[model samples]
Target: MNEMINRRKLLQAGGALIVTFSLPMARAATPAAEKTLSPARVDGFLAVAHDGTVTVYSGKVDLGTGVRTALTQIVADELDVPMNQVTIIEGDTALTPDQGTTSGSFSIQNGGMQLRRAAATARRALLRRAAAQMDRDISTLLIRNGVVTAAGGEGLPIGSLVEPTALALDIEKDAPQKAPGDYTVVGKPVRRLDIPDKVDGRFTFMQDFTVPGMLHGRVVRPSGFGATLVSYDESSIADIPGIVKIVRISNFLGVLAKSEWSAIKAAEQLKVTWSSWSDLPDQSKIWEHVRNTPVVHDDVTSRLGSSRAVLGAAPRKLRSTYDFAIHTHGSIGPSCAVATFTDGKLTCWTASQATHDLRKQLAAMLALSDADVRCVYVEGAGCYGRNGHEDAAADAALLARAAGTPVRVQWMRADEHGWDPKGPPTLLDMRAGVDPQGNLAAWESELFVPDGSATFVPLTGAELAGLNSLGKLSPGGVLNDLSIPYDIPNVTTTAHRLQSTPLRPAWIRSPGRLQNTFANESFLDEIAASIGADPLDIRLQHLEDARGKELLERLAKLSKWRERREPDRNAEVVTGRGLAYVKYELVRTYVGAVADVEINRKTGALAVKRFYVAHDCGQIINPDGLRNQIEGCVVQTVSRILKEEVTFDRSMVTSLDWASYPILTFPEIPEIVIDLIDRPQEVPWGGGEPTCAVVPSAIAGAVFEATGVRLRSVPFTPRKVLAVLRAS
Candidate 1:
């Protein structure tokens, strides 16, 4: 069977309707050779059928962020169709345009806008056809519920205008879009499309997907990083039932079996010898290592007046150092993928956020043309950033090619927690000066961070197999918000890009903004405490952006923020509220947060009681979905700040299970209240990561208020808290 035809059949079998453009329509275009995946083409994004149902093709997959429904809302509103009449297909290399990775919360901001333009173009074309067919002026026709009607009540279904053909027109750069005030669906709190299937256990996650005659496979990783496989004894797993094949290429090793359990047993029982490597620095002194690492180059992100001169002339100056611990994606489910190679073409079903990029990587690893590889997206574990999904896809592809059959690879828990690329540790040094009148004078900050972003994180299986991979280290884009958002007399910020880090680095949500904002906002609070000023008041005084100031004020009103006074040192248990704000990336979304916390002086135990957030991302697509993202961001960031950390020795990671690396529990969740500010006339920004940037700083500020001890490091365990308390 033809691979493209086979893929369509598979999609149809999975309950999705696949519509193809007619030959006549394809031939009607000015350029007959125009690519089907062209982002500028209307047919690439939208397909209309005789039954009036519309199909939308998008390259950006939803990573459990509810973007699937949100994108649908954008299309429905712009195309004047019922939301239910539209269905979307996402992240198929052969089916959807390459909209790049679904990271940085750009799915709606970038990809949805592209689709919206395409939909608008299609709507315009359809309206023209309807006008010609009904002998009415185009301006006198209105589309409602996918039906074009004239002022005389004569109407035609949208499907009738484009039956047996495609919308072969190019997308108009200035296509007409529905006004915000006229929208009836885009901003509404429509229920998520994936929720019902997920709740009822009917959603087909990547782990549940399968191909005919597929074998179960599992990769065997080396004992530690940089370890080289010397030998493996296949006879060791001879007694294992259903063993199919043992694939060993260079340092890469894996086992295939007739069943999933058989693959697991065979992989675990197989004997392998490997050379050892212990180059990682001690975790206890990771901060020192980060500070001392050789600098590749200095990125002067922001510089205003002469900070050195102002600080020298100021009366009082304060300095503080802060660090964030390494973290894992901690996906609830392990990564999984299924792959098959037939007639020199490989097809893979994966949950990778960047399927198009994965397709290229897999093709390079296999030494095949890009056109010969196809990557299909299936919902799987929610990886907020790059995790093991792409690696698992590579593993499945390699094993499938070797075994001469379809193969499914599922990563074990240990594999996920121990081997997945980590969110690298971050260190920042902050300095601020206050004038004689107790006003801010100067501010300076320097960040010691990894040299690259997630774009450089290599494919694990390819790297292990001695195939093509980007041999560079990255901790995502942490350079964001290195420059503070506050308006000050003299300000300077620089990031010292480190040549090496303690572990293989990848992006884990908000990336650099989360870490930098933690330092920026918390240090602002430290300055406030030093000068006996209210945290909220100090932020408001320094902020100049109208939107940022409004967000802070709204946060105060929502949280019922009160001015702080001197702490009672004699109290046994103390309660305090702290404030933090961020203009994410210093330009995009704006967020303000308040954290209420309680602490026990005796045990040095801190408990967050509540969180109040004020968020403004310009325009709102789905208010309910935006709220869910903010709630999840708060919960997860709380986990990252209070509990999560990846432990490692010189040779390998030691935190391989939940007990070793704890996350926040359900019982520990705090009451969360959010006030969303909608600016309908302005362009929509990202909602996924903006709110997370404030979480750590807010919690840190709250911890400081509850106890006069500042938490300069993350994962504030009781031991660290107690040690700081005793030292204070």
Candidate 2:
């Protein structure tokens, strides 16, 4: 394995390639070789060897978050070295420490701090050693540009002292931590290190990974859920020239071929029959069953107030049922994995957010120790929590073990969309009780389809125990309002588990919060309209405390919510404004949106012209990245709200591709204005999921302002709008 490139060697007949090495000037008394060094090079006083090349490891990934640049700035600020000298390796299990996943928008909060502390510790050690050698106080020794110098003159570069010496220190438990005053770097935006490589097309993603003797693999999956591959007649593909071997496992059947194209071509030639349970149901029937289930995890799930009493005692109450159909992530790139098992060692290259979990799952499935399995992170095209790299990696490993060779399994875009674990269709029945004074008194909701509290994915004993003890199954955090951020006198929200197909329903951006907020916020807007109170004033009346107030204040200012007006433009076009609020964990984010829709009074074509969004996710890591995420969310939400839906004909999805299940294109994308407010960095909050929670509700509320009709169903397509208008 070459540590410089951070790639596993194929292990064939290849002569030794002359590797280049750069040695830094080492100071005396300090040993040259310290393998325990945690790539925590902040002051540039230390360097580690990776296949003879000096490299620096930063605990951040270029998950397109630009954390690599931010991390290098921290190193450059302390080390007094140029940015070019820093060669960063990211998210590699073999070369880098387990810095955890790059989701949750917490890379800088957690990973960035660890790297900074490590660097500070290393710098302190080097200066202390220099002071001991110079016979001066450790405080007098200042390090600048990879060298230690006395207060007056005469200095030595720390790199000059290179030997086998133990330089072990603990920076993990130091209290009080580093103050903001000591930070000369970290906060400043640094140039991204991955830009040049990406521009040059040299960055190696999972799609770019290729081995010298690797074979392409394709798995034959069951057509529907609970279906098993009864048998496969490979005799039909006997004439296919490049087809090499066929391996069948307990889960899936795989066919290996010489080329990726060839493997896919040969897979169609094989005859396969699948057998499913007799009582196979369709999407409509499945949703109907879900909407009528009883709440089981009430005590542990939702905690607002008693719904039965609130609904019965209220003088004025509004009750409506909202339905969200199943939708796939539809990531631009399909799921891919390449696994090689040779000489009792296993290495998997894939795009995964959960690397440690993937490694542990694969190791247990292969009956191998944790050390035998390694996962190499790759570039992800689009990961809205739908890249099931673990399944892909395990599938590849299973095929490789059967063939005794490395295999790369790649799913086609259609196959990925058809089999992708959807975000799970939800049925939300919400009831609100409002007093004559227009103040909210009671609120209640019944969440159908299991509340997404757990998943059925295969896991090891340790992983299962952790999930069980913590009670955090897949989308378990769906109870975003378990604490109830509003000041309603009495509130009750309970989750009911219903029997759906065995599809792994995980978090998709905001997940449960988005669905819940859309229902809650839109209904709140309706209640405000009914009471003749300003939407902004109504929200201000009950914003919990100070943090919620800050969000509402900033968002209202951005959208000018005080001067509200109903759409009275041309008869064919109308415009309106809407607001939504979301509080996930301890972070509070509010969004105010204004939308313009062009309606053809004759044709009934409703085209969204523009959407304005304002968000407050506290401290911003990269302002550009933050704004882009919010704008992207707006576009995706509009698309989903308008044309995205998985239509069902029988038991299978009919709208499987772009032709049927349409996404927003260039023409459909409206002008989006994103304003971010600086809440506070006292503790870094999340930006990724918070911004996503507002869009669906904003669009829904905006449409009501435009059409004077309530849309209770998702994917308010043009035809659906036409139907509503015609029925009126």
Candidate 3:
């Protein structure tokens, strides 16, 4: 896990850059092989018409993340064109390269970097042509405002120089990049391009999208996992106005209508009798369910020296268990997609994060080639991870392919909650021992979770429908962030994947890494308390990385270190501060957070008053974007810790509406402050998900500091807090 970036795919054509990697395997792979993998594609094309309007095409779409503006700024600055001249087209698979999904927070680091280098290469090609035409050396000329200049002798407009001939074809992997100080657009915070439309209500999300002759449709989902449709009476809805058709294959049932309300009303009246299944696990005993399952794979993720030997010689010891419950994405509205099947081709406009993957999966489902189907990304609800957006797309395609017409399918909110893939429940056991000096020891952790390969979270819609599935799983993240960064003598981390479970897990936000971080950081704080040491001080002592130390030290200052205090055993309302640190995937996105809380003694209610974070994600593409990502992480994580959980009965999911499943309210949000460390020389890293991994532990520490108690689980509700207090 070394620093991987600052990459350029070296080209013999004109020295254009692609992606830089620190992995030897990636480096050893040939250019053709790399293309076969996650190709660093420059799908963007610069078209300069006679009027000098520059249009750029990108494979990566903007998910309200302001990437359109950032990528536009990169191209404008690098190509020496006016910002106003650039228009970006994204997420149209037919016209763009396969840049893969916009997940993992790598859009800017991977997508924007390639676009920047591509524009730079285009500029170089323009200069080469200019140099040839003017009979002058390339270095002697300067470019400004999309025009090549030479000693005030001649000014050649880019529009005149482009096509009949294309400059991009001759451009390769290497090009002159602007130095940090010379950057005018890359580092600054520009206004987002998509915000104005959203504010004015002109923006159309998938829920509101309409096409000529498009029919509205709805699906009747199963009551529970393994449920089958026994019978359905379509004649019951025949009286409904504009009811076009009812399509059902196996358990999948859909109703299509000429009008939206007609479709919904008809579907509601179309009675579907579904057979139930009694095999689902009880929600109350999720931890037990996960632990009791047979192991599909059990292996130590990382080990250094023998932890058993070192801990056996220690003078003191402590052990703790942390459990995480199933949760949902909780989007503002139900998932929706629009699909058109015409002339043997299927086209879908969806909000899926992975369009290429969606296209491939849909093609496979329909028994068609990739060319016969296209998935175009459209703005939907802000999907944090694998939500039901893609599933809705599949529903639309399934119906549209059958109806042979344009169809828009939208799942009801209850249907969404009932079947959406959930974040897997986990039980983590941590054991460690402190030496005589209370400064050194051995550490070990065991993660009891769903089978690594069998339960590997699904990424596509086919997996959710149970018709098609991704066969294998990646080895990493089974116990990511479990490896201790502390300078310890012995440490061991093992992961046990459950052989089978009813739950279908998907990558929700940070996935298993966030759960693992919550456990490890909270347990570390517990260890500090047992050893009679301050949490911040203990971290500073063991963390040898300067970046980690810098984050902690900065957060400590921002949070006002002098104000934190020891836990008070007898206070009407307890108030205190606590700290936590994390590195995403163990080597990327270093983050530290300090949280302050006020806890009510009688009711055991907790309110986080403030949270401060220090982040080091290498280079700064957009300072405001980084701050927004950190702030979003803090708010969403606090919501997860305090109120959100997926609840289900033994045979069915009961948390089907907002009343059953809750999220953070506007009034409950706390003040979040962010500090960023920028190293422009290093490769830019992602700031999307990892910033959240530090939040739960920091909040837990703050609660413990306010009261003479410890929190091992999330959503430290009044009932749970009271139970812990009574037992203590």
Q: What are the root-mean-square deviations of the candidates from the true structure over C-alphas?
A: 3.0, 5.9, 8.1
Best by TM-score: 1
The prediction achieving the highest lDDT against the true structure is 1
Clashing pairs in 1: 478-512
Residue-level lDDT tens digits of model 3 in 1-728:
22123112211111122222112322211222222122242324555555666766566777666777877887888887888888775665554566757767777778777777777777887888888888889998877888899985688887777663454353357788777777777778877777789899887777777665679988866666767779999889989999888887777788889988998898788888989777888767777777788898777888888899988888898889998777888777778888877667777888877777777777776677777776766777677777788778888988898888779888788867877677777789999989888765889999987665332234334443445534334222446776767787789999888776556666678777788888988988998999888898898999889889988888888877756556675878888787889978877889999988888888887888888889999888878777878888899889888877888877767888988888888888999888888998887888888888988888888888878688887777778888887777
Please provide, for model 2 over 130-244, each residue's C-alpha lDDT reduced to its tens digit, 9 standing for 90 to 100: 7777888987876665667888887867665322231345563352333444444444444456678889997766767676667999877666544666788889788877888
Q: Which prediction has more favorable TM-score, 1 or 3?
A: 1
The true-versus-predicted C-alpha distance at residue 684 of model 1, in Å, is 0.9
* Root mean square deviation (Cα) for candidate 1: 3.0
Minimum summed lDDT over a 10-residue window in model 2 is located at 11-20
Model 1 whole-model lDDT (C-alpha atoms) = 0.86
Off by over 4 Å in 3: 1-50, 168-171, 452-466, 469-478, 563-569
Q: Whole-model lDDT for model 3 versus the true structure?
A: 0.75
TM-score of each: 0.96, 0.85, 0.91
Please state the error at residue 601 of candidate 2 in Å: 5.5
